[model samples]
Target: MNERRRGPVLIELEDGPDTDARQGPAEAPREPGPSPADAPAIDDPDGPLPRPRTMEMVTRLIGRPPSRLTRIFINSGVALFAFLLSIAALDFLNGLLNSYPLLGWIGIALFAVFTLAALGMAWREYRAWARFARIDAIQRRAGSALAEGSLDQARQATRDLLAIYHKRPEMEWAAKRLAEHQAEAVDAQSLLTMAETELMAQLDQEARREIEAAARTVAAATALIPLALADVAAALAANLRMIRRMAEIYGGRAGAVGGWRLARTVMTHLVATGAVAAGDDLIHTVAGGGVLAKLSRRFGEGVVNGALTARVGIAAMEVCRPLPFIAQPRPKVGNLVTRGLRGLFD
Candidate 1:
């Protein structure tokens, strides 16, 4: 039994230099991996990314003019629809009159009221277009005066400017100053410059305030509102209001239809001039790319929207202004954004 025992046997090996040499050299001790603390920090998961360019896209869509065929079709459709609607309404009214005299009278009265309202709206639109034309005339006169150095043209432009602002109480002081100093200006350039210094300065400040307010509104809406297309709508509405206010400040006094028209004009100019893209780069540079990198994506988008709004505001200023910037420098997007977005990110 002892000879045949199937018990487990154990073998022990001793460590030796010869044994170590036989085995391939032990892997060089791995250098300790850098501590987590030593590792470079990652950006915040919520940190800013590239702007969505929602506003810019919207601007382009609105700015692009319809083709002639499209315009014709739209016009024809609108006219046909209106005609059909009118015919239907009249047929309904006649039937009502035959069946229910009292109700028909009421309907007639309602129709009359609607007609008057339509007339009023048309009148207002007419006035708005006239105001825009007047602004254009003043700008042309100012340009001509400067180019030709014609004192008479300058004086005439000044007079038109005065006439435009005479009704506003805010302009009384500036108008007085302009009238007083304008006489001292011997040359066309000097007179217009003086007028700009006195009259335009106030308007410019007001316009800037409007732009800042609109920018703030757009930025806030873009950052906070998560709903799709909400930011675009807000941006469009804010821009429309801003453009309308600009027109009023510069004496365009645009009505609802006219305001939309003016906004289209501004967006068209911006798209054509490539200012929209340029403005984006300018804003990124001025705001410091790092600042946006520290912000959340939505917040970064908001900053960009606000900056583009400032650009639109500036363009609106150029369009609505009765005179081109001369005595005062055109407001820079960088400066405006810097001032406008103050405390927003902080």
Candidate 2:
């Protein structure tokens, strides 16, 4: 039964030999694939996420319904289709057209117009979706690649960025800037690879120098450690409890000062001392820090020690004559306070 009611018409087909049944709700007419909004619900009884539907198909497949504008176009199309069918169904049109003047061709013309309009609307939907699907695919791949942190991500991001580039007419400005950024990022990665290779090929003289220097500084600190510890231990003696506590503290301090085993402990202590930067792990703590930063504190300190040592060495040579000066005793705050309080008397 067909009638022109200026509204949507729904056709129902029941489960028979022609239609598969025994399932969930009535399946919407199977489109090419599921749309994102209608993507299948997936969970891990064991593991593994559900697969994603392409974005374009996502809406159509899942009834991830398109916009009202889309509805407008689609409804328009359906309306046009029905309009044409109505004219064709009207058998009186042939005779009416034969009898009437301009009126004769009117039905035929409406039929042609509505037919073309329906086709155009359907085509627009498909075209918009195909474009969106391609772009969405590239984006999904790009996101996955980046998250994977593989070199492949570099390739995918670049491609996705390019795909996004061509997607819009107004995107030329964004595309140009992004292209420059991608180029720079790719170049930087390449340089890092090459530099790493060269550093390795040389057998890591730099690593050797830093590690060796740390080993030496630890040794030197250990050598002086006994004297420093003894001084602290002597003052805390008499009180056995205090003596034990002081010994443990200084012992840990001395051991960790340069001991390879306690490198982390010592560095932690030093930074906490607030003599240097306020931080826990310097690399993570420092905003906008770079590769050299990735090294642990112990290693960084080793390199820094080398630089400082060089500076000290240069200064040592220029220190031929200490600035001639008379030794001034350190101010005695206790004595000063006593004298001041003794009353200003002859």
Candidate 3:
């Protein structure tokens, strides 16, 4: 019988006495038995292979799954709406073009212009939206981080976010305004504190309080003068005989004379303050009556030239001089409303 040979067979022939002697069998011949790691077991029988979806399918899968024929419905709906809108727009355009067939040309020209305008506007809007989106996301994340008690993260987010806005001119301006307002408030508070401290240091507490109280009273009184003048003007507006005429209404001798006298008082205040007025400015005066008559004479003009002229100077004086002193302005709705409603009756 011919000897038979098996192809690469291995037998455990009891590890013949010298098995551990020379070295491991030629690089530890790859095991013929299944490996523990590679054993075909459990539910898996094959290796992984790629069957990636197409781009469009991937988009739908990651976002909204397509129902095979469903996209047609959406596209059809959009197309219908777009077609209707285009038809309406075409009709409107056709109407214009119908007037002058050349209007279609004009419209095309205008359309080009408007298209450019729309493009520019869209570009601007997209830029603004992009900026705002970045800002909003950063602020949102900053708020979340703050809430999570990671102050450093919140601050970093805030600074990074605001950095872009601070680069804008309008934002920079607004920030500057806010800083100025805060500085002014701080200065005002500091001055008030200093004033109080000074007063307390210079005078007994009661005396200081009294002085402050008296100062406030004087300010309050002064504040009433402008209002008083306004009331006087309001009182006269209805009764002035020449309410219509108004050319150089204050040129009347009486008004000029009156203005002179008032000017004198202003000069006196200047003098008291150790200042002086020019000779011409203090040249003349009204022989009789105070500011009321003079100013009354000023507005005292009604549809008449002399009356208007005579009263103009004093009236102007009364209105302008006292304004700086007044803090609270009186409401004028009553007289204004009455005048407005008069039209109804008319």
Candidate 4:
């Protein structure tokens, strides 16, 4: 019986070997190994994510994480203390004024003068604000004309810009710069560079001076004013002045829309770069007890803000510049800070 089946068995073995050689034993049906979704989730293979909240950043800096209740209590205590201090300061001033009629009368007169001056300033600010729209319009028109490569239109735009500057002595530098290419048959980019160079070169010193002055003013106000809000108000005013001055210096005084846009952008830059908080940290580091501490903190804050302002001014320069700095090296923050700090202390 085995001899009779041998031929069939031999034939089956030969067919199996041929099938295995051709198809390689069919791969055992591959049990669908753990899917892609089942794999461990990975962090950004690129880099770390950004922190959104200021307080979150604060927690990281301080090392020890405080509970929500503790943070709330601390903030509440600070607010209460400031409020009580403000009330006491007001009461003290009132009692002093009551005791001294002459001094009170002098204070009244000074207050009236200040009120008038403030009104005058408000009127001037309004007028200046009005002029910004026209200024922005002129700049846009010129920029567009230049983009079209129309030399005549660019020259006309230059003339228009100069027309505004002719009456303002503060804009004499810009006027002079623009006057150079007012009639020249140059490309828009070249003309724009000349104006930027003239306007921005002088700004290194002027901007620092302005920021330092603003810092001093903030320090003085913080030292005298009992309310923390007063410090905020002073800083706001100072920033406005700094930005406005920068725009003017850069030969492109921004309109209300432009000013707001610029301010928003600059503030965003400060916050994003941690420049705003950096100033606070610097002040806190040098800060101690009493009036001197307050002044020091304010001063440090101002310096930090001023440095930020300088950065804003430099940014403004970039925004207003018609052409990129191909041949020249762009201004560096380190140099600006060094110069600004020197100017501030000096």
Candidate 5:
């Protein structure tokens, strides 16, 4: 009776096919790959490096990799030159032999010896130039590695760089520190920081002294000299020297291109911040009637310019050094200017 009273073919709509049983759980949407903008850009190591126009031309003339036809031409030219040299040398030797019996043999031997020596010297010079190029290239690679945050590669490059300083007592400490850093397993930033702290201490100190001296000189020139142009010229000269020294310290002995780059960097810094000329009392100095006031004004201007020059030097360091100021904060332009102004008055 209860079975007969059961609900008439009641379909359980809520209890239909279990989605989990039929289709299983819906798979999560696939994740997208990184966008092009998000992808990191790596510098191509085999790409052409920056060089002065003169250097580029010279490199093309001598060190450039030749094509098949170019190589054939070069070989042919070298062969022709060698053939001409042999003909000239043989003729001279023959003349000597005809003129004097004993002297002729000696002359022939001497000529051969001199020719061999000359060739050896030329080869060595060529090798030296090539070595310098290779060293610069390695430095460029190290710089790139540092930029990419590749510490191991940068450290290895630093160590290899020490090879250039062999037998140089002045750079002995740097060599030692580089060796020490290489011996230890450390991150690139740490190694660079330590190198900057310890190995670069002397260089930094020397740079500071140079900055101070330049500042004083420029200030003296500006204050003591009557002509505004003279003061400006003096400032320019001091700034240039400071920049060049800084570049050299940072292992970027400036070729024309490098010098131009450094100059542009300094000029850009000037344009962007006006950090160098911020605190100068140029009008008061120029208009002031009294000798003391004028002297003080000139001194102040010099100090300001020198301070700016120092800033340029610091910027040069950043430009020339492969590693950036990642581990430590770079000095602020405002802070530097303030300190410079204070020092000038004091």
Candidate 6:
């Protein structure tokens, strides 16, 4: 057998007219295509618009007032339940007394304890409402004083403010300073402004800290929590706590029910003013225009939620503060967000 052609065979073919063997004019080296980082992002006709449904839902739930029918139903149900509960309790006590004397005595003691607790709670509720009333009265007086330039009314308002903050050791110096210089104020506006500058400056700082904390919590929850409605719940809770703190900072010292009421009031104000929704202007102002592109969807939502929370906190401050923001500038949502979320994203 012919030692099988072990060597490799080469075949040659003629090149077609289009197949240039020699490199022709080096096709003007295609300018290196833009890099992913440097290339302009393709503009989508339909942008990924942010939907802050969490804050929206929370605000709506808090802000919307109960309908008359709903209120009636709730009130009637509570009354009926209380009446039935009392009857049942009495029957239970009678049975226990007839059968087990010792248990009956124990039950009586428990009932007494419960009654005392209820009474105490009622008293606290009353006091909370009274405090709220006092704040409202102060606001009205301050507004009237400023409007009418009534120095007397201004002095009254200042006294009320001083009384509210009198127990706060941190406020002692501020109170003293106000008392000393308040007399120098010639008009109502001047007097109130002086009081605000002296007293509210510290309170304002504290309230801002509260707002920033709430914003941070809300942002973190929105960004990290994956469960449905969890972020909404967290945001609502944070706002409620923040509002309550705001009230306390401004000397409202709201109780449980009062705090909830104050939160509702703040939410109502926000909803009425259409501040619940975070717009592009707000996002750009707070986190800059590229935040959405640089961050994930959750992060973007977080930023928006945090900004809305700051807005709610500001509203709460306004509602809770006895004096209007006449002397001190109101806290801005952008500034609060920046401070609150400073290292969060980084």
Candidate 5 residue runs with Cα over 4 Å from true position: 1-148, 252-262, 268-299, 326-346
Cα-based lDDT for every prediction: 0.82, 0.35, 0.35, 0.54, 0.56, 0.83
Off by over 4 Å in 3: 1-82, 85-102, 118-128, 149-152, 168-346
Candidate 4 lDDT score at position 57 = 27
Clash-forming residue pairs, model 1: none
Q: Per-residue lDDT for 152-261 in model 1, tens only?
A: 99999999999988778989988987877788988998898898998899899999989988888887887899987888888888888999999988887788778878
TM-score of 2: 0.29
Which one wins on TM-score? 6
- When summed lDDT is taken over every stretch of 10 residues in candidate 3, the lowest stretch is 243-252
Q: Return the TM-score for each candidate structure.
A: 0.81, 0.29, 0.23, 0.43, 0.47, 0.83
Clash-forming residue pairs, model 2: 34-57, 35-57, 35-58, 35-59, 36-58, 38-62, 97-104
lDDT of 2: 0.35
Off by over 4 Å in 6: 1-41, 44-46, 272-283, 286-290, 343-346
Count clashing residue pairs per candidate.
0, 7, 17, 0, 2, 0
Segments in model 2 whose C-alpha atoms lie over 4 Å from true places: 1-84, 87-92, 166-170, 187-346
Residues 1-346, candidate 3, lDDT per residue (tens digit)? 9988779867555335456655455343455786699866675424222211121121122224357578789889989997897687678778888777787778767767877996777665555445434544654554455356554554455345335434555345543443344323223223222322322122222222222222222222222334544433332322121111110121111132233333333333334543222122221111111222244433212111111112222222222221111122221212222222233235
- Tens-digit lDDT track of model 2 for 1-346: 8985797888775764446554445645666775797866574233322111111121122223358999899999989998887766566678777789477688778767887997877665565445434534544544454455565654554554445443455545544555545544444234223322322222223222322332234223322334544422321221122112222221111121112212222223333444233233222312211222243332233223222222221121111111111122221222221222232221
Question: Top lDDT: which candidate number?
Answer: 6
Which of candidates 1 and 5 reaches a greater TM-score? 1
lDDT of 6 by residue, 1-346 (tens): 5675688788654344436556453343357786889876687534665566678788887888899999999999999999999899989998999999999999989989999999999898888878988998999999999888899999999999989987799999999899888889888998999999999998999999999899999989988899888888998899889988888888877778787788788877776777755564375644542356355878777877888888888888878889998969878888888899985656
Model 1 worst lDDT window (10 residues): 281-290
Tens-digit per-residue lDDT, 30-91, candidate 5: 79988998776674334322211221222233223449998799899999999998899889
